[model samples]
Target: MKLCVIPARGGSKRIPRKNIKEFCGQPIIAYSIQAARKTGLFDHIVVSTDDDEIAEIARSYGAETPFRRPAEISDDHTGTNAVVKHAILWFQENGTPVDLVCCIYATAPFVQEDYLQLGHDKLIQSDKSFAFSVTSFPFPIQRALKITQNGGLSAFYPEFRSTRSQDLEDAYHDAGQFYWGSAKAFLQEHELFSNQSLPILLPRHLVQDIDTPEDWIRAEYMYKAIHSSI
Candidate 1:
């Protein structure tokens, strides 16, 4: 069986109530739930959260809140792997045997259903433990800069300073949207960014990280630009 697990903790420090905060028109998490529902991929779409309001909102958007996440795993220090492992264990104990699972982020407003389907297709066909969203860096990461403690700038790789941008190897990063993996992979806490993971590349414009108010504004504009036609 395929399971969709969305991890939403209530202790966001940078942006308060970020998980359910409105973006564009509705709660940001609503988009994720809607995308999962639209794909018709998962046997059970569930949201694992610590807050009552989050659970209620998730259910309203057609996701199952089978259990409240434990406080130990709901803190800011908690990691995605721990939250996902908890959900997988819950299913195993409840007699629901899930073969494949996807951990969709609660704040991913730009998530696409087609990519989710694509990731699932890749995961099933390959021996990799994961197939998740990833996107190329707008500029090569090889020539990244850093600010020195002396208030001056320094190149992370000074050797690449004279190299042309096009000559630099292309780089990519986790879009922080969704992660699809086998139930065993989640339970075993396998790393998600290794050779064992398949990359489901997404257009960079569709990827946004909404951590602060400025990020929220940029995301709103980007969302309008792409979704205006729809």
Candidate 2:
């Protein structure tokens, strides 16, 4: 069975109650839950969270919270891989064996059903073991810069310093939205990306990683603009 896991820890240092924080009139996590359910792709939508409020919000959005994440896995220093592993183990112990696993972050409010279906379909069609969303860099990454300790600026890609933006190859970065992979592969490698991994490119407007307040505002505006256009 395909399982979609939304890992939301109680302790959010950036935005308080980030998972349940309102975004465009709905809890941020609700967007992902609704999107995932809209696709009807997963056999189950499980939320693994340490916060009771988050669990409640998740359940309100039609996601299942059969287990509360352990405190050990709810810390800021805890990696998502560990949380995912713990969730898989919890299911195993509960007699529900999952065949495929999709890691969907609770903060990604802009994730759409089409993009998710694309990733799932790609993973199922290809020999690759994993698929995830990505978005093209707004500016040429070759033109990126780094600030030195003494305030001096340095080119991130020194080789491309002399090249023009148009001459540089296109590049993409992980959208930080979601990832899909075989449960067996995830258990064996303890990672979503193995040798066999595919990048599913998404429109830049639909991709936003909300980490800071500024990012949250931008996401809100972008969401409005996109939906209004629709």
Badly placed stretches (over 4 Å) of model 2 are 190-194
Deviation from native of the Cα of residue 96 in model 2, angstroms: 1.8
Error of 2 at 68 (Å): 0.7
- Per-residue CA lDDT of model 1 for 147-196, tens digit only, reads 99999999999999999998899999999999999989888888877999
- TM-score per candidate: 0.98, 0.95
Error of 2 at 216 (Å): 0.7
Residue 49 displacement in candidate 2 (angstroms): 0.6
Residue-level lDDT of model 2, residues 1-230, one tens digit each, is 88999999888878888889999999999989998999998888999998889999899999999988888888889877777778788888888898888899999988889989999989999888789988899999889999999999988889988888889999888899998888877777644554588998988988888888999999999999989988
Q: How close is candidate 1 to the true structure, as a TM-score?
A: 0.98
- In model 1, residue pairs whose N, Cα or C atoms come closer than 3 Å (at least 3 residues apart or on different chains), thus clashing, are none
